[model samples]
Structures are given as structure tokens and as C-alpha cells.
Target: MVNPVPILQTIATETWIPAAWEDFLTFADDPTLVGGRFYYDQGEMRIEMSPLGSAHGRDNTIVSTLINLYAAMRSFPMQGFTNTTFRKSGLREFQPDLAFYIGEPGQTITFPARSNAAVNLNEFDPPSLVIEIAASSLEDDRTRKQALYQRAGIREYWVVDVNASQVIAVEPSKATQLRRSQVLPGLEIDWVDSALKRAQTEDDGAVSRWFLGLLTQ
Candidate 1:
């Protein structure tokens, strides 16, 4: 029996509260609860209801563009998902800011475009990489979120700290920090951090041109 979880009236965002898997899904599936990013793990659920500010939005766009640019130039088979919910049904559910499937043609996944559905983690293998934009807190991204993806067997994870212009890259499967992105070899975390810093002064077009130059050279 899944008891009801309170919506905006009583429940607050950014704080974890006990919720059953079935109950969380009830709220998750409700389109009326707009702009809520959710996570469920360890019998608890957290809703990130904070609005996306310019910094967060800009970083999200730049990071996605950089990753797609890299994948394109390398001719790597890649599929990128932005703000998509991925669920492991009874155990876990995560809506990452960005996710990527990078692998051989046979290993990559193509989720249907414009689908209002969450990716079934039980049906599809975990993504090659998962990226979370650090919102009001980076600790949550570094700790709980990292543990959730690690438990899900995600290969690589990155926490993009827009305020700090830092990208904390990790290999969750190996439980190690990744100086260079393993999924996209030859791509260093430092290179990405530099791009973010440059984007502060230069427009995305300039940043793209500079970022692409590195990939080409």
C-alpha cells in the first residue's frame, strides 16, 4: 500500500523525506508538478524545486554543447539526454541534468524523442556517463547522488560546479577520481573546467570555437 506523499502544501524541496517507491512514482508521473527534479534512494525521496537560475542554465548548456562537440569530432557513437528521469523502479530513481551513452554501436541507446517517459534502468543498462549540475549545494551531488549512481553501476559521473567553474569527474564503477574522461578518452577534466571559465567572458560561440580547436588539434 503506497500512502500519499504531500505536494507543495506540506512537503518541502531539497530535503529528503521517507517515501515508498510507488508513492514517489505517483508524484513523479504528475505533470502538474512542473520543474521538479527528483531523486529516490534508500527509502527516501528529495525534490529539487529550486528554479534554474542563469548560472545553472548557462553551465548546463555549455557542458552539453562541449560534450556533444567532443563526441561529434571523435566520431564516437553517443546519445545525450538532458534533464531526463531514469528509474530503477522499486530501488532508485534519478533525474540527471545530463547523461550520455557512449559506446560501440551495439552498446549505445536511443530513447525516443519527445517522449514523456522515464528511462527504465532495469530495462536499459546504466549510462556511460552521468552529469549533475551543482545547484544550491555541491555536497549532495558529491555524496548522496554519487552513491546513487554508483549503486546503479553508472560508469562515469561529473558534478559541474558552475559557481566555481569546476567539474568534479569520477569513475563511479571503479570508485576513483577521473582526471581524464574514460568514456571520452583524451578528454581531460581540466580542459572542460577551462572551457567553463572561458565561457564567463566569451560567448558560447567563441567558447565552441576554442573548445573545438582543442579536439581537432
Candidate 2:
């Protein structure tokens, strides 16, 4: 659930200056609210409140579980943890639905692993991959949010449109080059078409077997 605090609204108008920004940032970096939003300023952090409450359903859990298993089977040396507040593009604060640390976790100012086990945005080593489960927030997920992650230098971002049952993979490329998925590192992702194929071919039993096998393998 998101906090009810009006931090972001206040910041937008310049009604809140640097001093308030500092106070807010400090509040955000506090370890207590690790599962939600953490807004940042130059270096400080503040917890931003959201209207939605803690209401993740079973479908969310299933998707998360399946993705984790898929990554494991690929032997990527990943650590899959969900709903951790992260700083995106070193500017905006975001709580990815699920984020995977590609290798060993690293140290940072906000996430001083030694003193505070909180996942600090400043301290996040470049994540190999980040995934978002998209339902209603399709525009934000595919456009603004994707741009934010790309600018933040995320290697790969998978936006799973659950309603569509498809995954849109995004990554950075040179201005003169083509943009594509760098997570699978050259694999083609057909998004809608592939999802349609999965839906047409796989029954619930097959789908369960697919994920279970990935986890065990």
C-alpha cells in the first residue's frame, strides 16, 4: 500500500523547497518502510504515500513465482525479491513489482547493507533485470515507466501485461541502433503473438508443469 502523505504533490509546485526536500528525503530513507515508495532528493529519501492499500492478489503471486522459477532455470545467479522500493534512473523513486539482482548485492549510501538492510536506491548495483506486472497501468508501464528504467540503466525490463497475457521486453541501444531485449541477450520476444500462442497451446496443467519444471531444474 502507498502512504497517504502528500510529498510528491508538494514537491511539484516548489511550495516545498530544498529544506523540506531534505527532511522528506531523510524520512524516505528510513528502513521501516522498505516495501513501499521512497522519494529522493539530491541524496535524501522520503516515503511517498499511495492511495491503494496492500491488496496484491493470488494472480500477482503466481506471476512472480513463475518469473522467479524461469530465471533460476536459466542459471543467472539472480536473487529475486519483490516489492522493494528502488530509485529509478537515479531520479524518480519506484517500487518494481519484482527486481532481481544479477550478481552479488552491493553497498550504497541509503542502503548501507551493514547498518541498514534496506534496499537503498543509491546503493543498488546495476540490476541485470527488472519486471513489472501490468494490468490497468498500461500506458505508464510501457511508456513513461519504461523510459525511466532505461534511463536508470537497467539492462532489461519485462512488462507482463496480465490482461493480455504478454510480456514486453525493453532495453537500451545506441541512438543510431535498434532497441530490443538485452536480458535474454539476443533472444526474440514476440509479446502479443507469443502470448497468444501460449494461451492457444497450453492448458493449466501444462502451464503449472512448465513453471514447476523450471524451478526444479
Candidate 3:
């Protein structure tokens, strides 16, 4: 086991560093650092202790609510989770800001609501969609996290750029950017972005109402 004090003290936040998967698990499971978001990519790990300030909190909640509304209105069966840990045993682990298990249009979705303690990817399927709210870690989100999820076989990944008010949605499998969500079919990325912008000025209830109108129409 790596010495917890020295490794954590010397390591930088939001930057990948060479470490064994075992070391990564040690720091990730450390009780004192429970609130820290953890990620392991191949042989490197990144620990981010982002402040859930008003902007991040607002964006996270609004986007999550928007997804719930859209999926419900479109009759798509889905389950949403906040800050769920997904561990792939020896390969990878990611605790995303938001995650969802989605079903096809008109398909009777029965995706199990796995353990909140952390979905062991070795046992259950990975989440269909994973979203990260980049309150201050946009570069890390775009590059490191992107590459990690891609290698881990995440279907759809979204990086919600809190500063720019943009949602960078992509299919890691196809290696292409997306305007419309593949898993959610007609859910437009920019529409979600617009809602973020609207959310800055308007209350969440108002923005939600606007999104509901668009969804119903």
C-alpha cells in the first residue's frame, strides 16, 4: 500500500499522475476524502475536489432535471443518478457528476438500479450516459476524462462546460461530436445548452417550464 500522507500530499489535483490501480483504489476509498471525485485511466489517476458552488450546483440540477423531463415526456424509460461511482475492478473507475441508464424508444426498460455505494462495472452494465459538470475543470473533462471513458466503453458522454454554458456531447465509440443525443434520440445538445444560459438569468422553475413547453410541442 502506498503511503497515504506522502502520495496525497505530493499529488496534484485535476492532473493525471502515474500510479498503480491499487494505489488509486486506496486513495479513492479513503474515508477522509469521501467528497473527492476520482478517476482512473489505465495506469494513471486524477483526483478532483471541485467546489460545488452555486454555478455548478445550478447547472448540475438544471441539466439533471431537464434530462428527467425530456426522458419522461418522450416516454423513454430511464434512471438518473447523482455522483455515482462506477468501478471496473482492475481496469477503471469513474465517479461522474451525473449518470443515466436509458432505454430505447418504446422498449420496456428494466435496467437494474444497482448499488449506490458504487456500481461495480465488473458486475452490472455501465451507465448509458455519463455527464460531468466542468465548473472549473474543462480541460481535464475534455481530454483526460474523455479518453478514460472512451477506453472504458462508455456509450455517450457529456461534458457540461459551466463557464461557456455549452454541453459537449459525444459518442466515444464513434469518436464523433454530437448535436443530437444518440441514446435520447431527438434530445438536442444545444437545447440543453440554451437551458443552461436561461438558467443563469431565470429561476430553475421558469427554465424548466420553458423546456417542458418545448418538449410537449
Candidate 4:
């Protein structure tokens, strides 16, 4: 993990002194560190990092590929907001494995863009969906993050078990009930398997077609 202090120091001395995350957002567009990580301190806030290959390459690739594919289809305007710090009530910053806002094309809803752009988590306008890819920290994904997203009012949460090729979709339930998903959808998370199968035979296009069909619907 990158040290949070040095990163914040660079931002303070050489770059703009970020009062809120707007500076960070605009700075994030810079080409020098387009795919690099940035760290910020929000007092009691948590620190987050975002690099092209921070997570397993496979996990990042799958998310980017799927989000890009969905965007290409023009299904909706999807924002792949990954590894950004958000300040919510009780907690300071809670980063998700993946975050996306899926809404109708050209239908830009007027939501309060945080002045600092460190998303106003108190508003409870969580991302439409938050995804967690399990690594060595399975419990972190399953419990702590799950509860965080729940209190943040996230509509959907998905835990993608990379090795097992299974995706668990979870949603809210009553106090006595276990949180689960009934209306949430599913996706075939085995792109590697599909690719391998296609490589051994001339069924690559067929496999892609099937997956694309599933994605589109």
C-alpha cells in the first residue's frame, strides 16, 4: 500500500492544496498520473488508492471490460468510479471495489456534486451498485463493507468470488432477517473460462455472442 502521508505532501507542496476533492477530481484528469494512485486525508476519513493494476489484473480487467462493454452498447450512462474516498456520517471514507451509476442515456440527474467532490455520503445517495472482489480479505468484503454499504443506503452490493467464479448479490432485509437480493440481477463472471474454451476450438465468436446476449438483456 502507498503511504498516505507522502502522497498528501506532494498534493500540498507541488500541486494544488486540495480543500475538498474538486482539486483532486480535476487533478485526476492529468495525464502524468492518469493510472496512478492518489491519497488524501479527511481527518477521521479513511484513505484510498486507485491505480490501473492495484487489484489483481483480472479483477480490474473484468470490471473495466464489462463497464466499457455496457457503455459501448449505450445501455445507460455508467460511471466507473473506483477507489475514491467518500465522507459519510459516522464513518469518514469508505471505498468500494467498484461503483457505478446506471441511468438512462442523456438523462443527467441533478445531484449535489460535493463542493469538495468527496461525495456527500450523508445524503445517502450511494452508488446504484457497489461491487467487492474478494482477495485475501473475504471477511472484510462480506461483513464490514456489506454493513457500510447498507447504512450508506446503497441499492445493491455484489461480492465477486474470483476463484470460485460465483457472484453473491446482497440487499437489505428486516432487522431479524439476513440481507439478500431478490430483485438484483446476475452476470456470467467466467470470462476467462469462456475465452479458454473458445481458444481450444472455433467457438470463440459463439461464446462471445452468448455472453453479449446475456449482457445486453
Q: Of the candidates shown, which would achieve the greatest TM-score relative to the real structure?
A: 3
- The 0-to-1 C-alpha lDDT of every candidate, in the order given, reads 0.86, 0.52, 0.87, 0.52
Each prediction's number of clashing residue pairs: 0, 8, 0, 1
Ranking by lDDT: 3, 1, 2, 4
lDDT (tens digit, per residue) of candidate 4 on 50-161: 3333334455455545555655566565566765545553343455667766656666744536454656667636677677666554665676566667766667677766
**Cα lDDT of model 3 by residue, 55-110, tens digit:** 89899999999999999888888998898788888888998999999997778765
Estimate the TM-score of every prediction. 0.91, 0.58, 0.93, 0.55
Tell me model 2's lDDT, rounded to 2 decimals: 0.52
Worst 10 residues of 2 by lDDT: 103-112
The superposed Cα distance between candidate 2 and the true structure at residue 38, in angstroms, equals 4.9
In model 2, what lDDT does residue 6 have? Answer: 47
Tell me, by lDDT, which candidate is best.
3
Positional deviation of residue 149's Cα in model 1 after best superposition, in angstroms: 0.3
Candidate 3 matches the true fold with a TM-score of: 0.93
Output the worst ten-in-a-row residue range by lDDT, candidate 1: 105-114
Off by over 4 Å in 3: 1-7, 110-116
List, residue by residue over 76-157, the lDDT tens digit for candidate 2: 4556666665644345565667776654223221222433334655655645667776665566667656666666677778
**Which structure is stronger by lDDT: 2 or 3?**
3
- Give the C-alpha lDDT of model 4: 0.52
lDDT of 1: 0.86
